[model samples]
Target: MLSICARHCVLWSIGRCANGCRTRTSHSSPRFPKSRSPTALPPMLKPSVRSAHSREYLGTWGISNGAQPGLFTGTCEGPRCDASGPEKGYTPHARVQQGFLRLLVRAQSALVQRSHHKRRNCAISGARFKRAREVVMASYIKRTIRLNPSQARTLSGFANRRGLSEYALLLKVIDAGFLALLHGTDRETDLAEMASVIGSISERLAERGTSREEASAAEKQIAALDTREAKSHADHKSLRADWRATAEAKGFGEAAQARAIAEAKERARAGELAASPEILAARAVAWAAAKLSERQAVFPASTLAREAGDYAFGRLSHNAISAAIAEAGERGALVPRAYLDRRGAESAGFTTPEAIATEQAMLRLEAAGRGVSVPLASSLAAARTVERAARQSARAGFAWTDDQKRATSALLTSRDRVAAVQGYAGTAKTTTVLATYAREAAKSGLTVTALAPTASAATVLGEALGLRGDTVARHLVSPEAKGLGKGAVWIVDEASMLSARDMAALMASADKAGARLVLVGDVRQLGSVGAGAAFAQLQQAGMATAKLANVVRQTNADTREAVMASIEGHAGKALAALERGGGDVIEGASRDARLATMAQRYVALSPTERVRTLVIEPSRDGRDTLTAMIRQQLVQRGELSSAAVRFEALEAKGLTRAETRQAASYAIGDVVRFARDYADKGVTRGSAYRVERIDPDKAAVALKAADGSSVDWRLRQWGAGKVEVFEC
Candidate 1:
């Protein structure tokens, strides 16, 4: 810092005092009057400092290192004397801009100093340092040091903007002198987290008592809001984002904009311009580092650090010259390397870029020496259920909603007592209710047969109840229960989705097995498969009626809407309302960058593949053809494999929805191939399913039979099967 400050002030006449630094008054030098008050010039002002009336007025001026520090009236030549603008103040726009930067610099300084004070234990009574225990009980510095996913994101943005390594930013912050802002934030966040969890549970229960579906949804919603605000700040506002984007619109040709800004900053600090090759070498080294990482930007334009030092600087634009060079066993840019060489040759005390670069290198090397690893989540719900041995009950009476507990106590108080659970809304009501009943029933040493109308419905419920996670297998009689001493209870999950044959077979098995039958599902959500619709018909016949009201939806609006809209037939409209913009749209976005990004997401793609995209105005007709063209193109361009395509509908796969939604606007004759995403990663081979139905948000499809069952596909994967109708 001292060196940087010194360099900034060096070219000015009133230089900062240093150890034994000397200066002689040059007769021809121009003089500018100093002022005791900022706006008031010296009483004895002069056009030039004459030998007879010259006296240093060092203390008379307010020396802000920022440009335009008051006029220095000296008869100097070259830059100092070159004709400049009449007034030293900034132009109209600049005044505001400069003022803001000055304020920011001071703010950052204050933050830095505050941290410094905390570390040094500066005066206990000092206001900023007071009540240290409470101020830092949950130290931000310690937590930030842990490198959580969120903080890493923030650090990455900062470093990327400055054209520095993220590793460098981490080191800079951890520098003991910079960690003073660690007060109260962590504890406050923790309190919020707890409150959020409790409130979500309470709200869920109030809305839907004993409704198992609602409880599961409420948990996911509470978590999304918890991170949204934090994520916004971490993402950077779109305003300043344009300046940081790596593309043609940045309005530059040769090097990176960040690199240019860095060079300008270096020049501002080094008043007389770089006087040594070491400075130029630093730029070269910086350049080399960028070229090595496809992720890093190349600084465009000739740099001052290079221009002022060596011939190597100009050579950088040449094809073969690497931006940096290795010198003395350390990675160094030409400027720094030259500076280091000159230092050895001349014994100057100036710091070389290579020295600083080495320190940064060592830090990276040390971090890389350590290794760590983690796992993947592909249907974590099912995995978790399996891990718990299929138990859904909490240690304390299953953490049920009061209404559910009431129902459980009233109708199910006795261990072997039979109760037919029911509900619809906020979730897959029928399925959740039966699953909960099945869970409680499991502990009675009695088997519970939860029948689902369709294989898909069975698969959905299987996620929680610990079954084969398949429908066909779920309804078939298990040999283990052939002659059970204790009778089993029957549960029909998504009973509305069962076919006549499956439903009849299920009923036969339940009756023969002496199982008490509990049929559940939302007839409004969708009618049952084939004759399985018989269960909902039972309600019309009046066995026992239980209607569920009140909604318990997930924190994620999309998931909640998906469950709700399918029942109402508007899932697509709800989903399409979500705003989406940030993505790879601008040209010159390195294809590789886009591809690497996809690897993190739908990992099966490579950078060089020709990506297919379509632009269209909002319209209602001709979407199918467009979707098909896209799919055709994918196959034509070899983006998606052909063997993975299938043509099956929700019926073939056993999924049910409200009459209006059953089609999901299904063309009634649509077909498609399916693909499976592993841990949301690789697109598994032979995983293609057929698109059986279509709607605003997605197409419902039956995945190709692997062992034997239909698959549910995500809307995002929909490619070429779209209608192409457009408006002029």
Candidate 2:
């Protein structure tokens, strides 16, 4: 029976046995016919039960069941079969059959040895293999990791050296790395324990003989580590929560959330969202509308867009802002104005509805002022006397230019209550023309009153015109303002700096008091800080204007030319003229270096030259930086005193009428500096005083000056454009 089973096994292995046995062929081999079954196969030749390992090992060789069909029944009729096994003429070769049996025995023995070796290895390695198998079986997760070319090459090289397929090598590497990480954590714990033991020993030693500082330092180190560990744990928990929230928002499952979080972090690091055009546009438009609503009611579209870009912190391009503006306008969030057509709105400007109403009110005030006549001179005799005085003044070497003379004559003789003099800068409009007007108006029995937008300007105008200077804001709230009538002439310097609201108020007061209002300033200079180009608008409306075209303040011809060019908005030509006139444009590698260079140059100048020098910077930040550098240089050279009194100086801000009228805005003990003279109350311009008390019910404040003198000042006296506060 053993011989018979062995022969059948050999025959089955060769695929030559024929007892309804199907021939097993390789995938690429040809199919063969099956022989008819004569009877059932011998019982010894039937399929047998085998171990799982043996089945798995033999499965690769296409031998799952033991002793394939037709192995024993052998009514052998295969093309290669002799058909003479025992009862047939032919029989299998003894040598070939014996060799095949030996080969099979060796293969089985090798597989058994491999299995035994794996078991022994697992036992020696603390069941590492078993754990790995369990891990593989428990987790069926599939992941694809992309590698760069360099990493791919490195992986390939390592896999080849280790005689492993790439997939097997990756799995092995992952397992090793995981084990190493766990081992590292265990080592850290052990080291921490060792450190604790060492710290205890050090403390004990210090109590006996060692220095206390060493022990304390070790204790501090341990405490610091504990703190760090606690902080790290907190951070990890927070990060996990945040990641979960993000994953939930993105509808990501647990397995995919980690990859999504990593990708999001990568995008944030790259600034993919913050720098996007859509984000920039949205931020800019929102910030711009907010700024416009808070401060100015109208702005040049381009200027507002630029400011909005800065507000967005992105400094977006003009095109981006333009697109945003177009969208905003369509939605009625912004009103485009000053444009002849829709197309011109891009370049003309933008305004709020409130600003448009304010403008209309201003125009109405102007029209009313034009109708009310306040004749400065009662007769031709009075006018002749004024002209003679002007002529005498010009002959005395303080000669008025033709433009100045014309402006003065116009102011003196104009019958309208409101008159405008469009003077350019450095034209001596205040010193020569307005001074002449004040003298002539006074001689003609008209009381001349000088007002300016700021304290320093009001003071200068008052000095030039030989009158008490006051701010427009202060004059509006003064007691003497009610007494203004037919015989009064009011001269407002820096008229261009008055917002539409302020201008309208001034006009209304003059019209009501039957006083002549004379506006003197260059419309080309800085516009109003708060809102509305009132002066420019009035001039555009063809108000009676006497223009001072020539500039006399600048004696140098090149400087005068540059001034004229600048006034005409030819900035390039003005700069060229300045350069030709020995003006130095200092530049350096960076802003700091340039400021340092300017400061050094400033320090090298004589006291008088430094006083005369005007450092004009476009931005407040640049001015501050340059000023700080100059101050440092001055201190180093001992040109300025090192001793300094520190105080909080609040720069004046332009406020609206509503803000000025709010009594709740005022506080007790606040220090304020008046920008206009209040002679009757002994309050001088540019004098700082502390608020002794506030009477919100009475709308008044008690102010105490440095000299201990106090006055009950009206709350309206603290109007915008009239006072500044300082904290000391």
Candidate 3:
């Protein structure tokens, strides 16, 4: 085989053989090993470059390094070599667009010649062959698109404006359109927002000069108000000082005198004295003034009206004041006017309008602890059926925690047909739902499905319930999904994350399917990414709800207590617990600096491929800053290459429509990470894949797996319609 193959390869080689025996060598060009025997040859394995994956495979065979296949010989020759083969079918100098095959042929011819004639008599390495071939026939497909008159005009205008060619302009337009579709934003809302922005800009321009003058006038008014306020406060202080002097002169400023007044109030309450306001005040004053002033400080009848205006605690009736003075004169306890003023201040603090309103609201919350119920249309008999199911769930053979059992019970026994089960983090809400699903499956063989506003959350729900999970949008669009038969039930997780619009759509779908829905989430966690709070509104509108309070996931009592406290809004407690656990709270001069510091700390952890840590950031800006810093650190550590430092410009949530359209779009060969898990397909969330092909017309995409295989991944799988592109 070696002899035959060597003869055949050598015959196919290019370059003239001085001996005219069909044997070839690179001796006419660079250095070539002298022929020991004209029977040695390179390996006959064919290189496959039909697809992107095939090119990668060829680069790794036999020769691990991606070197060209001229290693069998001591030299290599370019197309300029005096190499000749059977009739020279393809002239190496052809002006036609050279493709992979043309390049392959050129490389193979030179490699075969050197292999057959080389002194080593060794086979050519595959890695070297691929590189040599790439250097030869580098190819491209030239496609000419015919545009209509209007499109041509538009393209030319845009190109001229951008200082780019019409072709580049077209590419830009395509890229922008592709991103808009990938982001999945509401067109109407975007337009409305755009209009609002335009209006605001116009208004600001019109008001610029007027605003400066108005600001000046406002400053003058503020200064006047400050002056008046200062005078009024000084008068108040002087009045208080005078009242205190009178009280001290009468011995009423003593703590003992105040204590006596308190005792007298108690006695009056116990019926030891008259409980009338005048009598009570009189007794308090007389008891307080008794020691120093055998006579009480007196005000003239004519001056009483003027003096009463300075009285504290808003205004007191003249008759009441006169009666109090008379009693104080008789009791001989020096009651100071300053004491009355202090009492007024304390009363004002306690009975502010806002404080009273808050007290009323708290009362309402207490009353609504069991959750207000909406009347259901079901009859007693129908209700009893649900009640029985509820009982059975509690008795089911699932390993349910107390909280889980209660949560399931709440779902089954909700007074209103619509209800929510509010579970705190790590409270086994998912576990409870899965148990119910199993129970329903066993009794009536119902299709217990799970849906979420996001693909990732839905996937998690589906996994726990042993069913396929899908986004709520998918169920809403399919007519078949409407009115899930009576036996079917749908569980919606992360219910709090659904915007009002999404909630309405999901509800409409549920109504169509006639399937029962059980919403479960922790409201204290993140709300919807879009607009409006449907979950909170529903809870406020007297919707039936079961709030799961136990912190089931945290094993440490202190940590669990801290988590529960934080959820309940006890910031101090949460911080204390964290500090006890050796967690340090780092404060930076700015949020950006803090984020950078955090990135530095993460790098210091010395993470390996599988031992990575997660840095949870609350804001998008913080996340972006930390991400950039982390990328830079990785590059510095030699974990990433300079060429691989591509920023993943995605049209993710929280970006405006204009920004979304202007963001960078995905192209073939860009690496992406799956943001959601598709477990059945063995593609988990965070898994990496490369974009193989993109069809902007169809909004479709193809992905190449890590193992050099292709998967028909559609746009729907890309961040559940809002394609989350990332650099791996």
- lDDT scores in order: 0.36, 0.58, 0.47
Please write out the lDDT profile of model 1 over residues 640-709, one tens digit for every residue.
7887656532223222221112233234334333232344422344344334435442323333334445
The better candidate by TM-score, 1 or 2, is 2
> Comparing candidate 1 with candidate 3, which one achieves the higher lDDT?
3
User: What's model 3's lDDT at 27?
Assistant: 10
**Considering TM-score, where higher is better, how would the candidates rank from best to worst?**
2, 3, 1
List clash counts for every candidate, in order: 67, 2, 29
Residue 91's C-alpha lDDT in candidate 1? 13
Say which candidate scores most in TM-score: 2
Instruction: Give candidate 3's whole-model lDDT.
Output: 0.47
Residue runs of model 2 more than 4 Å from their true location after superposition = 1-335, 338-350, 378-387, 638-643, 652-728
lDDT of 3 by residue, 10-121 (tens): 2123332212222222111112234431122212212211222211111111111233332111111333223342222111111111122222333334554555544322
Candidate 2 clash total? 2
Give per-residue CA lDDT, model 2, range 1-728, as digits (tens): 12213222332333332122222321111111123211111111111122232111011112222323222211223444322222111222222222233334333333334445444332111112222311321111112112211111111113342343333333344333322221122243433332243344345555546432332222322332332211111233334565456445555557676577657656753573357786678666765665555456566776768767765555577788888888878877778865333243345667766667777887887776665675555567445755676678668866657777667677766777789899888887777667767877887788889999999999999988778899999998886566866788889999999988788888878877877888988877877876777998988876888998888888888888899998887888998888888887655998778878887888899999988997777776898899888887889888779887776656443443443443444566667787788788898998888877876544567889999999877654444346666433
Q: How do all models score by TM-score?
A: 0.26, 0.47, 0.36
Kindly report the root-mean-square deviation of model 1 from the true structure over all alpha carbons: 31.9
Worst 10 residues of 2 by lDDT: 148-157
